[model samples]
Target: MFGEDSPEFSLRIFGDIGMHGDSKSDHSKANFSFGSLDFVISGSMGERLTFFSESLIEGEHADAIFFDQERAWVAWNEGDSFYLQLGMDNSVISRWNRLYNHGRWLETTITRPFLATFEDQGGVLPMHFQGLEIGGLLAPAAGDLEWVAIIANGRGADIEDRQRVHDDNTSKSFSTSLTFTPSSMEALTFGAAALTDIIPADLNSAVRNGSISEQIYDAYFTWLGEQLEWIGEYAWVIHHDGVSGSNFSHRLIYLQMAMPLDDWTPYTRFDLKVMDQNDPYFVPVDQDLDQWQQLLGVRHELTASSAIKLEIGFGHGQDRDAGGAVSSDDFISAALQISWTF
Candidate 1:
């Protein structure tokens, strides 16, 4: 990220597009596509405040595209100790969601772990919330308390396997995260997160109360070295009445490592996501504790502003509608992507 010193209006135009194919059982699949076109407009109001609006038009299929206002927010700095933001922006719920946005070139892997994509992209969790975030820093250097508190319209109603629009219920959600940097080792930080929201109850059954709540707990560790970076996170979701038939509980975890060697960097990650067999949230598709994938990739920087990445993933999982036996979409996949920005 960069800015002009003039404190006046500034605009930047950038985009990422790529194409790839996968060979499975001697058959090739072509998924040539465009990633995103972004327009960022930013400026400042004198000294203590600044604002930016980022608009994105993204590729969804071979011949289809969609436009979304992913970020349109303002930041007000209350000295070096506190900050406030409002409007449509990143929820900052996790390390990955905070470190990356629509910019694919900033990511080490061509595809995000299945768990981190935005809600519409089949992600199991909501990566965005419309509301406010207040955060602060107690100490400047590592080894202090850095925290965020979120109060937002949790998520919209689940319709056709997707969460859309505003909150389906009148109630909002409250969440928080706290990270402690050990004074002894500034490069390492450990964090804990907790959140709660309401989801529609199963139509087939009813809880003693009308509201069904979902609770989430997460923990993460990070280490940043001279040429290497390591990050690991784990989260669990529990609901008292997720499905019409029963309650739900699910867990997900991922560990990522990257080493930059000059213009060439090699990276790898392990991803796993699963739900208890009786997880009601996955009732639409009978869920099981059997979905996992591992990925390995390498990225080559073509220039200061361009990069090419290649990766392969292999995994297996099954989801059956209603209640059925295991039938799956299991395979090994490969992809090559090119990303650039300016």
Candidate 2:
């Protein structure tokens, strides 16, 4: 019989599909997807560290040889108050960003919160900072608090000047967060984080005239109980590049709740996002954007690690739509997901 200690190596296989109606174009395309393999290793070197990385091989970019992430890192435990980690690793800022694996079976929306996306705005922002981090518990109480700070190459993955104001430049991003688990008798915990990068003058080419660099300001919170959880975040961006109106502003607000009964859980969430197109530059061109989204979802847990889910949503453009005044795809989505771990 298989048990938790059957093997150290584990493999995970999963995929998600979304569609509307029964049309060829509408049914076959997926809004989000991923597949990967994993392994765990132990060595003669006392308390050797472990590592894991996932490459997106199917669903979104199915055929390309994409190295989406490479987190080959190691860590050493010094004690309860101190430890060290070296390699490419995700930042310690937001719970949603770090806890929500792509294969997770339950969520409030068909997509992630606007801030959770890894891009420039959401799809490719910095996910892993390649460097070293030293951190540990800062205080001991019924409700505990932990602290972390890292030194890394201030940019994200595969990003040239897009990740930071410089390309191949060496610098660091300083970040810290506080997490608390109150002494009260309730299943709840919360966290707050702040991050900033000091970029070099010569590498900052994004600015027009003066040698001002890039900056990021973020705050996040989460509360989870037996059956319900709440997540929220806010972020601000400041660019010191003096060309073409060297300023940028963006914000996000999301709220969601879920309840589970037996094997099924139903949920709903609302998202509001606003970005200034006039500052620094324009993406869609000539117009800023305000996006509003409403989502309703349900999930059926087949087991502790596997489940099936269905979701639907609608998006409204507050300003001009990039394609035209009318929305090109004001869509309704449905997805069936199956996930398991071994």
Candidate 3:
């Protein structure tokens, strides 16, 4: 799909093969499986607005139609100093494996963080939302500074109807982030964000009191070096519910370095994640978990419009013997991915 007369679109298909010598989950041995296919389509309306939609279809059902996200909006570009986008769209609040660019830079074989997904993990949080977003270049500080603000239906796209505007009091939520790029280092960018909402326990009714939520502080810095890219972030969440409390914090660090030699770019990564359990609002888990992963990836550019990527990873978890662990000793996986645009 290329244009409005034809339907502009893109696709990404991937598969993973792995051999495991562990004592954990089922299918611990060698296995081969398709990951997911990302399909997207867009159509332009004159020079001011556009319609865009994207979806993730997995396995044999890849041909099936399951709407993941669809947004139609109008945008105005009044010179280079400012731009405005208005309509139902994805939230511009935080950065995670899925929210930030696409799914290409992940160093792990599986996918992304469990908490960063759109699924329900004991009814905690939803991944995406419907809202009005406006962001653009703010000024020329030492180099460049960008600003973004969003005010949307506090409820995520998946649970929009479940939100009670009157009783829940979480009918709306707002978020914003400011990014700065120093003139000295063109490859480095840093930013901060804040989010607040009136969350609900379930979709029973629209009004659920005392279910409000807040995430006070979050910031990150990314550096794209000559032969490397590094990213680090930290966040703290506080809830009114006593059981859930005062300080719930998390820290994440990921570094990816690649060397370009001819048609191939070989890369490796190191990631560390920690969550504090001593805070008053700490959510206890079945086990205290820490994960270490090592990955080796090769990217082959077949053409200007398409490329292939092969990646392998070795993952290890801390204190595997004491408590029941998800993966036993260690796990390894290999994946082949193809991406293209039209």
lDDT per model, in order?
A: 0.73, 0.55, 0.51
Model 2 C-alpha lDDT per residue in residues 56-142, reported as the tens digit of each score: 333334343343443446677666577788776666655566666444444434467665665432332345566678878755557
Write candidate 3's Cα lDDT for 15-73 as tens digits.
Answer: 22222233334443443445444545555554545566555554422233343333445
**TM-scores vs. true structure, each candidate:** 0.85, 0.75, 0.69
**lDDT of prediction 2:** 0.55
Which residue pairs in model 3 clash with each other? 164-206, 167-207, 168-207, 168-208, 245-281
Model 3 CA deviation exceeding 4 Å by range: 1-24, 59-67, 70-72, 95-127, 155-169, 203-212, 239-247, 276-290, 318-333
TM-score of 1: 0.85
Model 2 sits at a Cα RMSD from the real structure of: 5.8
Model 3 steric clash total:
5
Model 1, span 230-255: residue lDDT tens: 88888787777533445667888899
Candidate 1, residue 145: how far the Cα is off, in Å = 2.5
RMSD, every candidate, angstroms: 4.3, 5.8, 6.3
Clashes of each: 1, 12, 5
Model 2 ranges off by over 4 Å: 1-45, 48-58, 61-67, 106-110, 120-124, 156-167, 198-212, 278-288, 318-331
